[model samples]
Target: MTSISQTTRPAYSAASPRSDGLSTGFYKLLFMTPTILVLALVVAGPLLYSFWLSLHEYIITYGMGDLVWFENYAVMMSDEFAGVSWVTMKLTVIVVVLEFLIAFGLALLLNQSWLKFREIYLLVLMLPILMTPVAVALMFRLMFNPNLGIINWLLSLVGIPQQGWFGDPDLALATVVFVDIWNETSLMLIMLYAGLKSLPQDPVEAARIDGASAFQILWHVTLPMLKPVILVTLLIRMITALKSYDLIYMLTQGGPGKVTETISFYAYRLGFRFLDIGQAAAVSFILLAAVVVLTVVLLRIMREN
Candidate 1:
C-alpha cells in the first residue's frame, strides 16, 4: 500500500486558473453592455455625427458642398462672430453670478427659524419655473412693451419716467437677463434649501453652543460644507444660462440692434434665417467646447476642495 501511494499527483492551483479570470471579465462586459449601447446611441452617436458634419461644408438644402476643413471654425473666430461670442460670455457670467447670489439669499430666508407658510412660499417660487419658457417670454414682452405695458403703468403710479425696457439697445440685454434670473432663481433656491435642510444639524448646533454668530457659523462651518452643492448648482445654472435662447428669441428676437444676440440665438439665425448650416454648426461646437471646459474646470475645483 505505501508503494502504491509513492507516485502522488501534483496539487491543482485553482487560484491561478485562466478560465476563471476570463469568465469574470466576460461577466463584467455582459453586465455593462446595455449601458455602453445606450451611451453610444444617445451621446456618442450624435457627438460623432456633429463632429463629422463640422469637418465638412454641409448645408441642409444643398447637402455636402465642400470639405472646408477648419474654415467654419476660422470664420467663427473672425471679428463678426467674435462680438456675438463676447456678448454671450458676458451674459452667461452676469446671469449665473446674480442668480446664484439671489437664490442663495432666498434659500437662507426660507430656511429661517421663524419662517412661516413654507409651502406657500415654495409654491410661489416654483410658479415661474413651472411656466412655459416661451409663455414667460411673451408675458415679459407684453410687460416690457415700452409704450403701454404694466411695468410702465406701475412706474407712472410712482411718478417715475417710463423708459424702454426691451426697446432700447442698451436696456434690452439687461431686461432679458432680469427675466432669466426671475424665472430660474426659484429652481436654484429649491436646490439650496434642500441642501440646507439635509445638512447635518449637530455641527451647526455645536457652533451655536460655542457662541458663534449665525454669520460666523454660515461662513466658517455651513458654507464650507455646502460648497459642493453650491458648485454643482452654479455649474448647472451656468450651462442653462449659456444655452438661453427661447426667452431671448421671444422677448427681443435678438433685436435692439442685436444687443441681446446670444451665441445660441446667433446660431439659430445662421441656421434657420441665413441657412448657413456649416457656420451654425461651428458656433454650436464652440459653445459646446466652452461648456465642456467650464464643466471640467468646475469639477476639478470641486475635487481639489
Candidate 2:
C-alpha cells in the first residue's frame, strides 16, 4: 500500500510564487522605471541640450544665433588649450600619486593593533574633510598671502624671501596642488584605512610565518590582495582631480595670467566671463570625453592586471 506522504501533492505547486514569471518581471521593471526616468530627465536631458547648444553660436547677449554645427568645436581646435590641459594633468597626477602614497603609508601605520589613542588621532585627521571645501580654500588663501600672512612672516624669520604664493605664475599651480592635497588627503586615508581593516588576516599571517618582513609582506602579499580596493580608490581620486575647480577658483581664480587655469576653469571663463556659451559647451564636452576615455583606459589596465 502507498503511504499518505507519497499521495500528498507538493506544496510548491505550479500556482505557487515560483510560477509567477511574468508578474515578477513586471514588478522588477516597475521598480526600475523611476530610476530610469530620473536619469533620463536629470542627466541625459541636460547632456543632450548642451550638445545641441554647442552646435550653435548661442549666447545670452545674442539670444541664440544660427546653428553653426561643429563650428564651435572647429574654432577650439585652432585655439590654444594646451596650457589649461597641462596644468590639469600636472594637478591630477601630482595630487593622486602623493595622496595615494601618503594615505597608504598612514593606513598601514594605523592598522597596527598596538597603536594608542587611535580614535583621537583619527578624529584629528578627519577634520579637514569635515570642514567645508570653500572654507578650507579661503583659509588657505589667507595663509598663503605674501604680505601680512603668517606663512610669509615665518619665511622671513627663516631668512627666506617673501614670494607671492598664488600671484606668481610659476608657484601658483604647485601651491594650489598642495592645498588640494591637504584638503582631500583625509578622504584617501579614510578609504585606505577601511580597505586595510576589511582585508583578511590569513594571508598576512601565512606570510609572517614564512619569515617575511613587514615591508616584504606589505609589498608582496597585502598590496596584491588590496588590488581591487586600490583601483577603486585611484579611479575616484583621478576623477576628482580631473574635475577640480572650486578650490582652485577661490584660491587663484585662474589668476596670475591664467597659470592655474584648468579645463573646467576654462569652460567657466568661456561661458560666464566671455559670454560664449556655445564655445563653453564645446570645451565641456571635450573635458567630459577626456574623462570618459581616461576612465575606460584605467579600467582596462585594472582588468589586465
By lDDT, the best candidate is: 2
Writing each residue's lDDT as its tens digit, candidate 1 over 1-305 gives: 75556445222333333644554456668899999999999999988887777778877889877888778888675776888888898888998899889999988888887889988998898788888899988888888787878999898999988889888888888998899988888888888999888899899999999999999999999898898889888888888888878988898888888788889999889888888787888888998998898889788877886
Structure candidate 2, residue pairs in collision: none
- Kindly give the stretch of ten consecutive residues in candidate 2 with the minimal lDDT sum: 11-20
Clashes of each: 0, 0
List ranges where model 2 is wrong by over 4 Å: 1-22, 297-305
Q: What is the C-alpha lDDT profile of model 2 across 186-251, one tens digit per residue?
A: 999999999999999999999999999999999999998888888878888898889988887899
Give candidate 1 regions above 4 Å deviation: 1-42, 301-305
Candidate lDDT values, in order: 0.85, 0.87
Residue 250: error of model 1 in Å?
A: 1.0
| Highest TM-score against the true fold, candidate | 2
